[model samples]
Target: MESFLVLAVLTSAARAQEVEWRHDYTFARREALDKNRPLIIDFTTENCFWCNKLETTTFRDSAVLSLLNDKFIPLKVSAQLNPQLTEALRIQSFPTLVLAAPDGKILSTLEGYLEAPKLAGHLQRTLTAVTNPDWMVRDVEEANKAITAGDQARAMGLLKSVLEDNQERPIQVQARHLLKDLEKQAADRLAQARQLEDKGQNAQALQALTKLLKTFPGTQAATEGGQLLTTLALKPEVKQEQRTRRAQELLTQARADYQNQQFLCCMDHCEVLAANYGDLPEGAEAAKLVEEIKSNPEWMRKACESLSERLALLYLCLAENLLKKGQPHEAALYLERVIQAFPSTPQAEVAQVRLSQIQGQPTQQTDFKKAAEKEEGPAVP
Candidate 1:
């Protein structure tokens, strides 16, 4: 009788390890919140072989099943059934796993297939993050205080510090949102200063820029404001003529570079001119040139076929150009090509970083050229 009882207990325990995924996301989210666990939403479509493979193989693993049962409130969301949720989350591929906090803020999104061990590892890491949400909450609180006090720099610093750390997905998302808000605030202030400068209110514009730099140091707006300040200091008529002449010179150079087949160099000149003088005729011409170069199939084919570091650099430039044009999907394809073709090169690492950023993954701010240089080590002959 005792031996029979032991066998029954073992069977029950084994059965208990099996994962039970909730079909309803609402219920799963409520349960996750009540249990203080992360919610794992597995997004799959009808025609995805990899999604089926993941369900059959990875999700069926004893360890993965156990982790899902014990640590997460798992929900299986069919793209067909949950079209709104899929669109809201921007689910682009099959077998995407989104780990979100109880309050419905996404913590991380893992795309594609993973073996049992890797999936288990990811679950464990997410569990750690879910269990330790206090640090992130504290950081957000402090950042809010800094912002309320009109200390933009301190707020930005605090938010960036949280982003730099390995925090939960919601924390990183919140940080990114706040950073974008801060950037917009800085931009608005810069715009106000520019308006003042354009109206020949140089002294007021200078004052505004000085205040803006103090509030939003280390931002793109501050850099632009600083450069604008120099131009503002000059007589308005002279500044206008100088700007026109400079824009023309840049456009001429960019055209020359493009004709000479220096695509990357041409892009640089055109981008600068377009950004700084987009209101001018020269600026419009520069922007047109950039578009022409970017859309050139022959130029792109040559860049892709080039040897060594140049190929990676060309790919990177193309990706950046596409991103600036608000075409992230197209940019990602080029980035993937760079990674696949030059896996061992420094450019590959930078490409990966940029790809992650485009995918809404947590990534640190990185300079592409600087990252490549660091990875390449000492210059080669």
Candidate 2:
């Protein structure tokens, strides 16, 4: 019986890991609410040490789970992983707890850690208010329900009604601001679609561009939208196809630079990729690479390099980081840098050996000019 209890406990924990907790609010819009249940959100992040500890410690406590599961649809979101959702909810702190209505109006938000019993008490209190009709969540909830039902007009009408009902309430101004902010965001996205197409990301850029031009033609993006249509008309469909492939290659090379610890070069490549092809696969890839290496010391140093170190030393540091990381493919790149930038340095011999290992060749060191012409870029020793 003791052994059986151990297995059962482990099995339950594993099952809990399979729960879909982190999700977008927009995704909730399409979900059929229980109407009987309230929403409980636990926003977290992979990088937050406290959040990880909470999951392993407090959240894993059986009593905590029992109360949460019974009272609310316990949801978890990684704030870092889901940035848009984080921004939508104005989340500034990790381990944010939001008690929400089924229609998405927040009942309350708690920021930071809460011990088991306190957390359970908070949920119970919020549940009591949610179950009562006189609570402000009702009208706010109704307005969001309209938004979910694709009745934007009705949603705005409901919001207007709520504003009148809550005229003396402090949240009335905040509600008005939310409406304006939403409108501003809608306008911004339309503008962004046009800006994207203007730069040549036809496939990734066109759908939103076309939609905005149709839906909000009097907006600034629509006036600028003609330039994109003109560009599209001038290009052969074949050129449109070629852009994606080229963007992919650039993005791949940028990621290689990052993995190799050539931080500044990697970031530079990504910036060029994103700016030129923000709607393309390469642009997306570039953006991801940028975010991944944004915090690296090598990246920061390279970006701040003042040329105090000889060029060879820079390449050597880059190569060492890459090699330490076990990314031989990227390490080879920095080794080449060392050779071209500092041929006379004592490190050149080690770089040569690394290159040989990279290519599985007997070492016959080549000169920088020959290396560049053969490799199609500057040969870093």
Candidate 3:
């Protein structure tokens, strides 16, 4: 009789529950990526009553089990154990459900207890949202259009977006092929620029590299070209020659604007020339032009009114660099200028945070980036 009861209990236990949940988040995340499916992450605490209730009840439902095992990768994580993941996801409550795309983008987050039907409904809706039967065809078609328009940057961006969104075999094959072709063209241009540089035709090489950078801003070739461009710009001979030529170009623009009585535009060119090539003869020329403008009270007033708005970005950039170099005092002076003079600009908003960091902290060792790091949200139970 005892043996018969044991056998019956074993049979009942075998038929009891069905959800195939992977406990390790890392393994499940890789599985989701490989399978090109979304993930359902269940966050729980060790002693949470609702989490236990969820494990025993809703997870046992056939519909939920089928959906999880069939359409989505289900991962169970302990909130107390995976603090990093919890903080990154910004979780703030127990029994939270995070539905994420294969690329790790959160599709939906649910906090508190969710019944079997509601959870299943949420999962089904998220699945429907991510299910795109035409993303492959649509993106490739748009990319081809961009390529035809001679916009290689747009084409590369579109192709990259496709590769990131979907990992299906067919889409992956086509997107990579197109991306490789675009990179090939960028590479050819980059090679031509290098040839010019090798021949000591520094000016022509700079022009070619600038064009390549503009045409393929995100490609590997453009990245190499950027390094080469910096190298060429750093050479004493190249630097001197380029600065002279560029300053002359700015002076020419300033002169043309002066002749047209566009004193504000003339001031803009003068400011750039004075800031960059201040020791060059063009700096004296720019100063002379500014002096000529100041003779006209109306022109000087118009320039003073317009120049601050344009210079706000430049000042903000300079302040950020100073902060990086542990010179917060200098950085703060510029930051204050942005806040006080160009308060309406987007740069002013950034400046306020950086300025506060300088005032709030005792040391000058902090950077704007560190000050800009947002505080974490409330803790998850």
Please give, for residues 211-249, the per-residue lDDT of candidate 1 as tens digits: 999999888999999898777657776567667878989
Best by TM-score: 1
* Evaluation by TM-score, superior candidate among 1 and 3: 1
Task: Assess candidate 3 and give its TM-score to the true structure.
Answer: 0.41
lDDT of each: 0.84, 0.67, 0.85
* lDDT agreement of model 1 with the native: 0.84
Better model by lDDT: candidate 1 vs candidate 2: 1
Worst 10 residues of 2 by lDDT: 165-174
Clashing pairs in 1: 107-169
| Residues 1-381, model 2: lDDT tens digits | 999999999998786644335366545433416445567777887778777766777676676666566656667777777888789889998888888865566778998887877877887776665553343446667767765775544555555665664432324544566555445645686668667666766665666656655644444555566566556646786276657767877877887877777777777789888888998777887888888776666667665552324466677788878878888889898888777665544567668877887789988655534655675765566
Candidate 3 Cα errors over 4 Å, as ranges: 1-132, 165-168, 264-281, 287-381
